[model samples]
Target: MTADRGVSTVVGYVLNLGIALLLVTGLLITTSGFVADQRHRAVEEGLGVVASHLAGDLATIDRLASTSDAEHVAVRADVPEQVAGRAYTIHVSPDGNTTKIQLVETRTGVTVTRSVHTSLTVSESTRGGGSLRFVYDDDGSIEVADD
Candidate 1:
């Protein structure tokens, strides 16, 4: 009887250990998922900032178009003053009909382009997580939908 009791005790302990391990594993997985989500959010926010800057520049180009007579206008935006540790390039091409703005992130391999008469398109490819492409249409609004 004592031996049976001892065996049962051991079995109980083993079962408890297994339960603990399973809980730990679940917690680890949950934590990992949370961290990944945070990183993705950060990257997305960075992209948002880049998009905003390009949109503002585009708006400026539209305004300039109304007043300026230049048929082909090109502006090289100064690297954004904020978002240190990241590098970006803004290219603007103004033609007789429409203006094209391209924003490229040197570090992330993300390209966002917008045309005066069309929607904004963004494409990103990276190791942490590969490409994301979306379009934002013009309607006095910010729209981000999968493409």
Candidate 2:
């Protein structure tokens, strides 16, 4: 009877250890995947927020230029050095008679472009820094410069 009792106690402890190991492994797997998913989601969401903000700003500038009597309108924006822990670039192009804002993630090879309708032609340039400046001329032209 004593021997059986000892054997049962040892078996119970072994079973508990195995369960604990499985639980820990499960937790680790879940957390790793959650971290990965959250990382990409955060980047995509941030890019989207930035895109919308820029689009609105550009559109507002266009409206102001057309409707208001202001000579020039200047706007500043906060630029991020990395998107999802990867370097990115912002491009403003004027070839199509519309200003296109592009955010490209170098590591992931992801590019997001937002096109804003504008009557004025823009000077094409690559912009980078802590902040950006958008100057709208009296004639409705746009000049993009970084600071």
Candidate 3:
């Protein structure tokens, strides 16, 4: 009878250890997921700030394009101080009817685009994965398409 009790006690201890290990693993996974989510949110906020600054710059470019007669003009853009690590490109068509700006955040892999329609006084901005497309309509509104 005593032998049977000892074997049962050993089995119970082993089962308890297994359960504890599983619980610990689950907690680790949950914590990892939470950390990942926080990081993603931070990246998104940073990208949003970059996008907003680009939009403001594009608006300035649009105003210049409307008033100036200079063809094929290139202006060095000033980005937000917080996003100094990212690279930005601003393109102004020769006609000055359309302007497109692209911001790429290397560390977070986030890309944002903003475009302005000078004739219509409309601006469109979008953020996400993949390539960005900017289309101008005759009515003066800008269209942003993301692929």
Candidate 4:
């Protein structure tokens, strides 16, 4: 009876150990997936913030061109290279009266586009580095220039 009791005790402990490990593994897998999902969401959110910011800035520039007394308005653009740990490229689509700014992630295909209503159309690149410049002409036209 004593021998059987010891063997059953050992077996019970082994079973408990196996169950604990299995539970831990399952929990780790679930947590990992959630973390990954949150990371993607964070990246997209960052892109949205950048897009909104640039759109607002461009709108202000357009207004400055229309309202300012200066014949030619020149301003420097302060832009970041990476948003949320990812590098990106910008695509500007200018129509007769509207400017569409598209920020596309280099590695991922995540893209955010913003359309700004303006009297002038402008173009610029937001890739990586340098002191970017923009010039608004007397005729209320805007153009991106190398600074």
User: Which one wins on lDDT?
Assistant: 4
Clashes of 3: 1
Q: Report the number of backbone clashes for model 2.
A: 0
lDDT of 2: 0.75
Residue-by-residue lDDT tens digits, candidate 2, 1-147: 999999999999999999999999999999999997787777777676676677677777667677778898877776676666666677878757578888766654666788988866677878652477778876658777775
Error of 2 at 2 (Å): 6.1
Off by over 4 Å in 4: 1-10, 69-71, 106-108, 124-126, 129-132, 137-141, 145-147
lDDT for every model? Answer: 0.50, 0.75, 0.55, 0.76
- What is candidate 3's lDDT per residue for 83-112, written digit by digit as tens? 433443333332355555555656656566
Model 4: weakest 10-residue lDDT segment is 123-132
Which tens-of-lDDT digit does each residue in 1-147 have in candidate 1? 899999999999999999999999999999999986665556546655665655565455445444565553333333343333445555545444555656555654656666564332222222111122222223222222222
Displacement of residue 120 (Cα, Å) in model 1 is 19
Write the candidate numbers in order of decreasing TM-score: 4, 2, 3, 1
lDDT of 4 by residue, 85-144 (tens): 778776666866888878888566778888889877675444442245667877666776
The pairs that clash in candidate 1 are none
Off by over 4 Å in 2: 1-11, 63-73, 78-88, 106-110, 136-141
Worst 10 residues of 3 by lDDT: 86-95
TM-score, each model? 0.45, 0.68, 0.49, 0.74
lDDT assessment of candidate 3: 0.55
